[model samples]
Target: MTALGFLYPGHSAEDDYPRIEQLLGSDIRLPLVHTDIGEDAHRVDALLEMGSAARLAAGVEELRLSGAEAVVWACTSGSFVYGWQGAHDQVRSLARTAGLPASSTSFAFAHAARELGVRRVAIGATYPDDVAALFAAFLKDAGVEVVAVRGSGIITAAEVATWDEEQVLALARAADHPEAEAVLLPDTALHTASHIQALEAALGKPVLTANQVTVWEALRLADRRVNAPRLGTLFTKEPLVQVH
Candidate 1:
């Protein structure tokens, strides 16, 4: 089995890992490590504060014990709030500390967008508008264009974790623009693993959510391909020439 490690922030959306493993099937093992950040880590500043290299390095150490070939920082805003160049430094620091290949959900979304042959996208952000803008900037740095955006003003991941399929789909639809090739949902806290195909179907276009891209990026860094069609176009599509 291909073993991948994910370092998620806090206790929110703890079910997403098992859901992703179920979606990706039993051929892979997704060992996870949580940073022990409390529920108060809902705001961008608090999330970033909890996402120090020291915290992630500790989680990576635990994940290494489970034989993880690669590690992914699974928090979107936690990395992107620092901007593109800063996020790169954070991943480099994580790679050094973990002694394995490393990447973040921020970079994962950008890389996944490029891999899907999408230049312009709409954003379904669960964060406040300012935090959502940072994600748009992160994608811009990666050479992707944000044609439209909609924020839910959700202040807490605990709240986002409680969202059902209908809520997620509504955000995705609201984010979709005529100019957008895909809808990008940029919140790892939101439960997106089980609703990706449904979102794609509803929008009649590609939909890339946080946890989905995080897992895809992890597999890519580990050089493993799942080819699962249920996970949306990111999994089933052939690669474009290296855009990263």
Candidate 2:
């Protein structure tokens, strides 16, 4: 079994990992270690602390013992709030500490978009407008265009985790732009594993959600892929080769 370790920040949607594990297959395992969420607010200062090296480092031992081959910082806001370079440094530190490949949800979204050859995407965010803008900036640095960004103004991961199927679909529909090749929901705290296919069917385009990309990112770190059509378009197709 290929084990992917996830250093999730707090308790919002950590459950998404297990659901994705079941969807991926019996041969794949997702072991999640919840890092300390100093403050669950989606604010900048709080997120920086939430994704700090110290908090992330605390989980490495647990994941190492879980037989994880690669580790991911599974919180989107926590990582993106650090910007592109900062997030990279965060992952690098985590990898060095864990002695495994490391990545974060922010990069996962960027890589997922690149893998799908999607240059333009619309964001359906659960964060405030300012926080969502930071995510847009991070994506822009990664060479992805944010056609539009719609924020829910939700302040905390706890609030985002309470979102249901209807809320998820509504956010996707509201955030989608005719010019966008894909729609992205950039919040790992939101429960979306069960609604990926439904969101795609509603938008008639590829829908990339946080938890979905987080799992895909983990598999990529392990140089592995699995057939999981139910996980949405990201899983149904082969990764596109991007020529830099």
Candidate 3:
């Protein structure tokens, strides 16, 4: 099996990889490692402020040393906080450091949107409105049109993780816009991957959660294709041609 490495902040293994395995159907190997980003309460803001190409390069090096075939920075906020150029530079630096392919959750969303030929999108954020606005700007830079955005004004990463499925579904439903061809839930800590199919069903549109896009981007970089119906629209839909 091909190996893919993920660099995350402060979540446990139990929280993420099981869903990835279920989505990929035992065809791929995922090796994940966590870097200390303070604590869950402060990590999102801290990573947003401190995430740099240098820091990501270091993390990728660590994952490479551990035998990761490709490295993925799994935090959506961290990559977008740097803006479009910064996110690109960070991914390039990670690839350079690991001598392998690299990507981030932020870029994953952009690639997914482009692949689907979606110009209009609705954003569902677990961050403050201001932070969500920043994410929207980043998406706009990537050529996606942001038709609508709704922020849950969540303050901390841990709080985001604790959000129940029903609450997430409700927030997504509220955030969905009729003009949007896709709805993006853009926080890796929010556990949106598992609920994507249900959300897509409810909204009758494509739902691209952070983790789902992140994994999809990583797999694309490695030239791997996956068809995971349980993971939702992106996977169920046909594979998109690589951008650039």
Candidate 4:
């Protein structure tokens, strides 16, 4: 069985992983482990200061006990606020601790964007503008083009977690630009999984939300991939990477 271990922050939206599992075929397994490594604050420094390899280490142990084949640090801001190299270090440390393939939602966004052949994207963020700008810069450093970005200034993860489909769709629309090939929502706290196809249909383009790409990247790191049509273009497309 291909079991993916997701190490999410304590304050993340609870349904994202479960929604992904429900969307995937019966052949895949998703097991989640949480760590008290995040704060309610959504500021740049606050988000950056939230998680660490040490904080995530115990989560790896829990995932290992659950028979997880791979591990992912599933918080976007927590991973990206450290910049590109820092994000790399975060996942690398997790892999060392877990003795398994590892990745983070930040890198997952870049990988998933490349997988979809999206050079330019618009960001629909739940963070304040300053925090959203960090994500846009993070994507730029990762070699993806940031066509446009808009933030809602949501101050806390707890508040973001409570947002419904309508609010999310509005963010997606607000962030879209004519130059963008897709609209990206980069927050693990935002519940974007259940409304992925709906958002895509509304936008008439791809929407690569944090939780969606996190699951996809975890599968890829584990050397497994699932093609769930309802997941939108990211799932339907044939990426350059080998899916075993």
Residue 234 alpha-carbon offset, candidate 3, angstroms:
0.5
TM-score, cand. 3: 0.92
Clashes of 1: 0
List TM-score per model, in order: 0.96, 0.98, 0.92, 0.96
Per-candidate alpha-carbon RMSD to the true structure: 1.3, 1.2, 2.1, 1.6
Which segments of candidate 1 are over 4 A away from where they belong? 38-42
Which parts of model 4 are misplaced by more than 4 Å? 241-244
lDDT of 1: 0.88
Q: What is the lDDT of residue 10 in candidate 1?
A: 77
The sequence of per-residue lDDT tens digits that candidate 3 reaches over residues 87-159 is: 8887887778778888888989999998887899999898888888989999999989999999988868878
Better of 1 and 4 by TM-score: 1
Top-TM-score structure, candidate number: 2
lDDT of 4 by residue, 16-63 (tens): 788789889767888888787655788776676676767888677779
- Of candidate 2, the 10-residue stretch with the lowest lDDT total is 235-244
Q: Provide the lowest-lDDT 10-residue window in model 3.
A: 36-45
User: Number of clashing residue pairs in every model?
Assistant: 0, 0, 0, 0
Worst 10 residues of 4 by lDDT: 235-244
Give residue 70's error in model 2 in angstroms.
Answer: 0.2
Order of the predicted models by lDDT, top scorer first: 2, 1, 4, 3
Query: Scored by Cα lDDT, where does model 4 land?
Result: 0.85
